[model samples]
Target: MVLYTLAPGIRLSFNEIYTSSWEKGDSSIFGERMLIVNFCIHGRCDVSLAKNRYAIVKENQVCISTVMPTKDFYYPRSLYEGIQLYLDLDILHDENGQDFLSALGISLEQIVEIFCEKDGLYLHQMNDTLRTLVKDAWDGKDDIEIGTLRYLAVRLLHEIMSMPAESETETYFTRSQIAMVKEAETLILSDLTTRITAKELADRFGVSESSFKFYVKGILGDSYLNYFRKKRMEKAAELLETTNLKVIEIASAVGYENQGKFAKVFADTYGVSPLEFRRLSK
Candidate 1:
């Protein structure tokens, strides 16, 4: 795949047709609020979002995600090819911010509703006509002029802004609770070798132990113990696949004192023993 800056605050990433599926870690973290449109011109892929949400984009389909901090990955299957258009809000703000919104038939209230008021990922599927237009633009991305690309982006976004807001799940966590949950995730994952208990996490975050657990469950949709176990398993798997450490050492690295228990959990999680997994990965 290749990424090209078609214009300021606008970029296109595409790849030549390939028989094998596209698979890689996409750790591109956007700093500010931005609009992104993804066009699956020639393949199907699964996108992973935080908090256990996922979106699947298929051939000839388009998906839009509004302003938010994003950390995601795409796993494509088959002749995987696609283009992503990034619209930076700062550049689009212009001299008078209202002018840009007016030109696109979007209002400040609507922007807030779709981008800020919402929780989790704000993604919506485009109608078929808009989908075709997006696909056409992406298919010709390599040859399209900058002006034409900008025009296409605006047109696509106008339609996207007009779509109905996605229904939101009832979130029980307040803003502070949500922030604490994020902090908790960082702290837990920060040290893999230490088993940090829920009480310890609550103490560190300065929240009551029960309240901390409640907020974490609300945000992650999993209990603290379950979530902690999952993270440790993920670390163990990464170590097994990427390092030359022995199984016992790997077990110790991820907070498991007993190698036998570690092997059993690894097998349950990955359907293979750690040694076999290492061999297969290689």
Candidate 2:
């Protein structure tokens, strides 16, 4: 964790990696009455909210919140890598000990109001511009000068303040729905030899196939068949590189009944045949 205090009440921190379920909030030093901007590069975030509810922040998305979590932030996958910018409005002040935010006018606040949920979180898909800025910062965060950090922080805010509200309605999943999707992952992925159609899986879960696909896309970031195929190909590649199995045997092990089809798909996925991949691994 690298934290840069850009100004009196504004700061940015780089969360490189956290392999834990929960992160105890330590922002007490920054005080309450805060606004947070989270840019997720990978992993998922579960922000504790009022009324025993939690808001999710998926990879490649931004989460803005006006209220700080009362206890800890939860990472459902036990992983989180991202950047968070904190603005403690209560402690924000100028050199003259005045409210410096007044200088920002109402544009910033308007943006916040438009996105912030009531004791929840407002999540947005980050644009390419913001993604590049955040990615560059995350890549060279330690080397950035203080002045440059300040500029980046302000520029990020400015970029966000300029975005118009989204016209498409955002969707929120219940905890039960999320749990159901995770169970589907285990059911299908644990044994790749059998193909499970999305309709079959959804029927087992008692959800519409369309809704099931939506949940999968939102939580896992991939459609059902593609995700399964990707895992199968990855497993096949691993076997080719590590084991002494023949190409046909490796193909069967990864649920491919036809060696010719397997080779074609493997070549498409990795641009190499199984035997060629093995040679390259050596």
Candidate 3:
């Protein structure tokens, strides 16, 4: 993570090739009163929000939030890249920060009025223009010219502030629900040789079938079978690349007793047969 001070009390951060192992969220170190915008460009992130609820920030999604003191936030995918814009009102309302914001036709009070409420959070899907600006932010991470960066930050901020309110807030699931989904994933994927149905997995975990599917899709961004199949194939690919195991043995290791089906799925995912992939690897 690289931090650039665009303006007093206004900073932008670029995260490149990062992975998180913690599940805690506390922003007190930054300041007491601040607005945060998170641009998830490549991977998904779990955002712990107020009232034991949480939000998921997937690729190409933006989270504009003022509610802090969230807990248990983590990155699902290992490699994550994104940009964070921080506006600490404590300093932004100061003489210099105030003067800077005023010069850009921005009133600090208005932003607070619109985005700050009890547990305020707004999630938006980034379109082409917004995505472009975020890309510019990424491209300018090493830029010595701070003026271009300042413009990019303010422009992205303005774009987010101008978007309409959405009802996706209701889609947020509870922390326990996320926990249940994760535990299910761990249990089912713990042993590649053990086969389990979606219904069985959900019932084993004490969640209803519908709620189970909802949480799986919400957290993993895919249905249970798709997510499991992809995970299996990932393990298969790693084994193929690293081990002396034959293709059939690798299939059983990833829970595929039928070599034909395993070959088909592997081919569909990687655009090559397992043997071809191994031969190409050599």
lDDT of each: 0.64, 0.74, 0.77
* Alpha-carbon runs more than 4 Å astray in model 1: 1-162, 165-179, 204-206, 218-222
TM-score of model 2 (CA atoms): 0.74
Kindly list the per-residue Cα lDDT of model 3 for residues 48-164, writing each as its tens digit: 766665767888888877776466556654557899878787777776535555688776567666655545676777878899988877876676467877777768867766666
Query: Residues 1-282, candidate 2, lDDT per residue (tens digit)?
Result: 678787787778888666434564465545656778889998887665655555678888887777566556655445789989888765663333443344544344665667764433577778888898888988887688987877777767777765555523456666677678768877766787777889998899888999999988766656776767777898899898889999999888878899999999999899989899999999
Cα error, candidate 2, residue 4 (Å): 3.9
**Number of residue pairs clashing in candidate 1, backbone atoms closer than 3 angstroms, sequence gap of 3 or more or interchain:** 0
Ranking by lDDT: 3, 2, 1
What digit string (tens of lDDT, one per residue) describes model 1 on residues 153-244?
66766776666677333343344565577677777677888888899988988889998888776556568987778778878888888899
| RMSD (Cα, Å) of model 2 | 4.2
Candidate 3 ranges beyond 4 A from true positions? 17-20, 23-29, 96-99, 139-145, 167-170
**Which of the numbered candidates is closest to the native, going by highest TM-score?**
3
lDDT of 3: 0.77
* Cα error of candidate 3 at position 48, Å: 1.0
TM-score of each: 0.50, 0.74, 0.88
